[model samples]
Target chain A: MRSFVERHTFWAIVILLAAVLFLWMIFAVWPEWLIDTLGRKKTFVNTLLNGVTLGGLYFLVASGFTLIFGLMRNVNLAHGSMYLLGAYIGYEVADRTGSWFFGLAIAFIAVAISGILLQYLVFRRMAGDDLRQTLVTIGISIIAADAMLAIWTGTTYQFSPPDWLFGAADLPIISVIRSSGDAVYIKYPIYRLAVLLVAVAVGVALWVFLNRTRIGMMIRAGVNDRDMLAASGVNVQMVFVLVFAIGAGLAGFAGVIGGTALSVAPGEDIRYLLASLVVVIVGGLGSITGAAIGALIIGLAEQFGLAYFPTYGVVLTFLIMVVVLAVRPQGLMGGR
Target chain B: MNSSRLFSGSFSLRELHPATIVTVVFLIAYPSFASNFFILQIGAYSLILGTIALSLMMLAGYGGMVSLAQLTVAGLAAYLMAILGDNSMGVMGLGWPWWLTVIVSVLGAALFSTFIGAVSVRTEGIYTIMITLAVAVAFFYFVRQNYVLFNGFTGFAGVEPPTLFGVYWRDPVPFYYLTLTVAAGFFFAVYYCARSTFGLGLQAIRDNPRRMRALGFNITLHRIVAYFFAGVIAGFAGVLLVWFNGRVSPGTIGVDVAIDILVIAVVGGMRHPIGPFIGAIAFVLLENFAIDLIDRERFNMVIGTAFLLVVLFSPDGLLGLWNRFRDRFRFRGNALLGAERVNKDDPASTGSLEKS
Candidate 1:
């Protein structure tokens, strides 16, 4: 009984606070039947699931941004353009092949190769020069964005996964919810679950790769000091090429996932770029752990803010960034 | 023979002589030859942008701090003038006269810049850049969202330039000459300041702050003073901008335009005062005319490419190239021209990024 109290106390307090907040919000708004639809227990659980999946997608997008910034002391302003490009590529591939899975594979490969080639060609030459590299990448981003606009024609395109992945289902263990209206009594997309799963698997893979591989060691050493690594006979050029590719690949992967979730549009690139920049700034530029922490905080803040304080929802993220900068300019997890 | 020639040429290029000649010729001939609207609109716009960029050059070029919020400061001054004083129309207005409003607005901008400079100057390099960016973004949101002060997003409209010498100054020719006179005045002021002790001290701080501090310079005060001076320049430009557009919107001060100012400073070369003029003229003309010929959507591609190429190949900027070209060519007398031995390390020194 003591252990139960320990586990439940925090959640019980949170629930009570949430209930008070909800009543306050309802008082602000005119009474409506919509609240009843939203108030169902299953709906709450589904919304929670949806919020986690969204956070998972944000993690995927911010991960590449963090890695590129952390490893290469260069700000890739064009990362947004890469995201947009990846989405368009995936959409077109899916359209042509009539297969979402095949399209995603093609999108990942195409964006990954392009990202690597871009690094090899341009960023490799701009090793020490930070500002110039920023300008060049911005130039590249503008060009790529324009090219995409020419092809995509400033239109928003939405894509849905195959029929099998269209509706939600109940897991064997979590049978508290049963089927209702062609879903498991909670209408949420299965693709969102797929995104969450993929993000988790990729996150795990990246963790293993960074901690357990020779290339990872080289990357770490390169991040610490490229000059020292070069003197120590590591092919620093090859390492940069690999790092840039990996960073770009992660962004591409995120693009496909995000595009499938949020419709692909022309200006979406700038939004993601800004989001990623905010994440990196708040998380600390060079820390992967910081990226995760930052992403989670921003995601939850954004979701909660949207639910409770829609008007100031956007301000919450920026305010947190300012507070973080004020308290610790190095960021939450930043060592240097 | 070499010693005699060097001695004779040493005093040839006086500080104000070339600038005076150019100013006089430009003021007299530009309005006379250029078309009516071109003389007024494009010319006035160029001058205003040039003046704004000049203040940025003082901060970024000399002080080595790139404040993206200069435009924000300018916007603040403009909006304050409209809201707090004679420019206001509604019940919320202060209802003061034009001159008082001008002083208050400009002072307000300076005070705001001082506050920002205090926080930002402590950080170095990219942190400084990001901090300024954050401030600018924050102000952008504050002004855009606050309907009571900035009229929400619509901002104030119908700001009129002050009439002088028995004429309404809104006429294109009058406005053009007005801008020219203002630009020329500020140009000389900045040029003279570069040769002044204070300006030299600021440059010293830029080159090496620790050494400057050891030499007994109050580094923070110097930076704030620089920021105040920059605020005045930007505030003056802000006055011109409101008059030009006849309306102010939140979109006027944006991240893209802030970055555009940086591009202008860098493209003209950060090393010289005249760089902004050359850069501004080229940028304005290219952005306006080039987009007409090409796809409007892809025009940014041209700008982006140009920016990259210029930063990569000619970090010294266009004016530096012009000086080089001028030195390379000779006239009928076959005399080798150009001031070749000017010391770049000296704050008063002219030319490119090379330190003498």
Candidate 2:
């Protein structure tokens, strides 16, 4: 019994707390139904939608960060650069070809290739060395940012999404909550809905990929003990390259999505980079579920802050971070 | 010497070599020989930056914590100075006596750093880095948004150095001398403390916290104290930094500046007490000249390249390079003098940890 606790205490406590929080969240959303039933303007709907969308994007970026850091123990500070570069590449492709699909495809491919080469050329040597890897990645990011500035200029650029996913639609589920003949449907944009859906799909797909496949098993094993895995006759180096590329590709994809939803500019890389850090910290490093959980909490907290307290919206995020640190330095998930 | 052996290692705390005296004399006379613009802008500014970087150096070298929040702490000091002392912005300024304000700002910043140290001390390696990064990022955003207290983006201005002892401290010569004196005092203090038991214990923890803890030292308390002392140094520099610029703003403590402090410390070499000072001078020179030499937009890229090169080529920085040259000649002298028998167990070899 004691051995059981010593082993399972980390996950047991985390999942239990998560279940409780999830139930509480469901109850908290019940207020929206009440507000909708009264036929009043559903103010919480927009905030909820935006928060989920931002969280999805944050998850997309941070999962990649988790992948690289978890499997190889490398802290790639330049992951944010990949995100912004993806936005720029996607923007350029969409601009010339008038095809959002092509833009995303090309951006994903380009960033993935860059990630592979970077792993081989730079991060490979500093694989286990955190300090050098951080410094080197920071250098890469600075150079990338400057080069981006030279080409993209410092001005903000908005991505044009394909027309089908661009407009607003009635909140279809709210029909059950509305009173008879007083139907005032909360209209949220389709792009944001699509963003949230895509993010969910990506999360589910990654979960399956990490848990179900041969490569996935190796990545989990590598994260647990890379040297031992390598000694067992697996080409852990190839697995490392694969994970790094995938993470970079995910960041790029998120960049395109983020650029379309909001706007991309010079400082967005650092902003998202910092956001990813917050996500990983709150979620626990090197875990997919942790990133997902962290992204949602951070996303929801930020949106609510922005909605209710417009001026102090930014402070609320940090306040939550401080609370998390002071309360549980290990993070919500208690992952290794 | 035997009585003090446990605290001071093999070196005497009051030992002052001939080179120290020459360096001191040269520094004291630098403003007289140089132009006012050079003395005030370059010399004094570098010392202020150097001192802040030195705080970071102490943590990284002695405490085994590489925190990115030092600049934020310094910015906190600078902002506090504006609020406590006289600021023309008029909204939050207390218009108190200068000395009182200085004391409060330094202590307040130190206290703030102790809190940061508390939050960060539990995590090891990259976790600590991430947590500190989070704090610094949050601080930047909080200051930027709180307009009533921080005056929003533009921040406060017209912060003046005190007219202490009936002499204006902001005059070029006086300001240069003041910053120099502060830099030197802090440098000697760090050198002295490094030889003290507390400093050695901190270094012991840096190398192996488990072993240090086994010996019954409270690691967390020591780290927090180190951070507190570092905060006081950085906060004092922050006060000087505000006076030098005559303003305080969110930009002063931005993420870029925080990272820049890390770069300055790393490039100068983290091992020695004098490394941050050297790094600051190099950084100031780079900042002043990099734009002209490279595409103006790519100034950061140039710094990035230099930093990467240093990390890759010289882990110990410029001081390491100096040691290499000195070691080559010293090896020859040792061979001629029949002192080649010195090995890793020798006290002299403790300083040379860069050997591959």
Candidate 3:
């Protein structure tokens, strides 16, 4: 136990403790007080639930960024704009077809195509050059954001799930006032649960793909030694294009999920992009596990900070980034 | 070892003697002849952005650290100015004299940037970008959420320039000269700094950090100084920006502005001091007039396309294109000198035009 604690002390242990303190504050020590402060236990439950789902969305977007950064030293500043493009496309598709799954499928493929185009057209020429590539991506993002604004206007768009997941799910637990016996069941949105489940399923799939497959091995090898990988007859360029497509596709997919949960607007793209950056930095670049760990901390901190402090919510998030950066510059789980 | 290497790195290898003279004459005479719209809206605005972008170029070109928080440092100055000086918004303006406010704001910006630099210089390449970006975004949200400090989204306005020597500084002609003077002063500061021991050493450190460290150079200390100096320049521009707009707000220093600053620097060509000003002129003109020509909402699309094409075609920027166009009219002997200098400064210099 001591050894295990020591192993995860800085990374997993810190996150675990944060999550526990939140739970203890809400669930154990001050449930009645929270109910009093918030006016209802349902609101508290919803807030906590929102944090988890938000974290899941962050995990989905950040994993793709980590994967691409790990394999190639390229920084895609356009990732968020691509995500916005996906969400906008998904919103249109789902609105037209009235089918949720079809929208997700189309948005995923379409965004993957866009990502590939970006690689073949822009990033391919600037191979191994970080600054120029970053600047190019920033320009792409700016153009993409502008294009979306032209088409979608400035209004926010929210997605509705298919019939099976359209409504809220009522749980067995109820919040009751100690004096009046007034009670209410905590009802959670079914779509948020779906988002979480989808995120987890994708997480497992990615782990398997990275750990147990041939291309995954090549990717790991590519990350470690690109020159040697190319010398060994592995097509490094092909792998880069592949990873870029997959990373962008994941962001697009998450965009659909996040757009559904929080609604899509003109500015949400940068917000999510910044969120992904914080997650990647906190999780350590190029580590999927680190991405997940980083996402949870950011998501919880953001939502929790908003609930408690309101005004200082973003500050809390920034403080976490600074602390993590100072404590472990390479990130908690990042080894290489 | 030529003293003229100061104006621009290899990209705009034109000697400063001719170019500086030409640019200065044009600038000084611009307000006297150009219409108010041209002077105040386009020319002055370009110079302001150009100054800020030049600060970014200093770090990126010489130090190899591309900071996204330049706008934030500049905004810090404007915010301090709004808080300290007389303002229409009856909020935090302490009603200090203009001279004291400007001094304090500029110094405050330097101190703020130094602290941020200490934290960020620990990382390199993409990590440095991420950390500085985080700091910029954090400052954006900090001002937006903390309403009492910055008046939230509405932002304090009516931050007017003080009248001195019976001259209204906010008048379009006077403002143009004011901005021009500051921008020109800092442009030369960057020029002279490039030729100094610190600037040359920074470039050497950028090319080979370990070798410089082994030879007893303090890499961190140098990087931090670069950030401080850049911040001071940006702060000067920010004060100008606030006076130009006659207000201070969260919108001015947001993440988009930070990225726009990067676009300006890169599109101008980070290799030279004049590149940023050139890029800034193009950007301001496009932003102001492009909306009339194209769909207003689609203006950013044009900018993005331009930025991409510039990066792909001439990574050194428009100045690079000018260099190519002018090289045909040049004597061949200087070209040989350029090649020899490249070999001396960076022997393994990839024959990439981007580097040259």
Instruction: Name model 1 segments beyond 4 Å from true.
Output: A1-56, A164-198, A303-314, B1-14, B81-96, B134-156, B162-166, B213-221, B327-356
What are the per-residue Cα lDDT tens digits for candidate 3 across B151-228?
888898999999999999989999999999999999978877876777877777777788889998889988899999
TM-score of 3: 0.91
- For candidate 1, list the clashing residue pairs, or say none: none
lDDT tens digits, residues B1-356, model 2?
24365347345547778887898898888998999878988899999999999999888877768889999999999999998888998669999899899999999999989999988898787777787888898888878878878887888999999887888999999999899988888887887778688788877787678887999988998899999999999899999999999998998998888988988988898877798899999999888887778777677888888888887777667766666556657786555332323323322122332111
What is the lDDT, from 0 to 100, of the residue B229 in candidate 1? 88
All models, RMSD in angstroms: 7.7, 4.5, 4.2
Which candidate, 1 or 2, would have the higher TM-score against the true structure? 2
What tens digits encode model 1's per-residue C-alpha lDDT throughout B1-356?
23333213222245557776986788668888898767765677878888888888888777877777788887778777677654434524576777887788888988878877876775555556656765666566666666666776777776776777888888888888777887878887777676566777777787778898998888888888889888888887877787787667778876567667767777787777778877877778887788778877677777767777787776656865665555556442442434343234334232222221
Model 2 misplaced regions, further than 4 Å = A1-41, A173-181, B1-15, B332-356
lDDT at position B173, candidate 1: 84
Alpha-carbon shift of residue B57 in model 1 (angstroms): 1.8
- Report how far residue A104 has shifted in candidate 3, in Å: 0.7
Q: How far out, in Å, is residue A42 in model 2?
A: 2.8
Question: After TM-score superposition, what is the CA distance of residue B236 in candidate 1 from its true location, in Å?
Answer: 3.0
Mind giving the per-residue lDDT tens digits that candidate 3 earns over A82-110?
Answer: 78989999999999999977889888989
lDDT of 3: 0.84
Q: Estimate candidate 2's RMSD in Å.
A: 4.5
Model 1's C-alpha root-mean-square deviation from the true structure amounts to 7.7
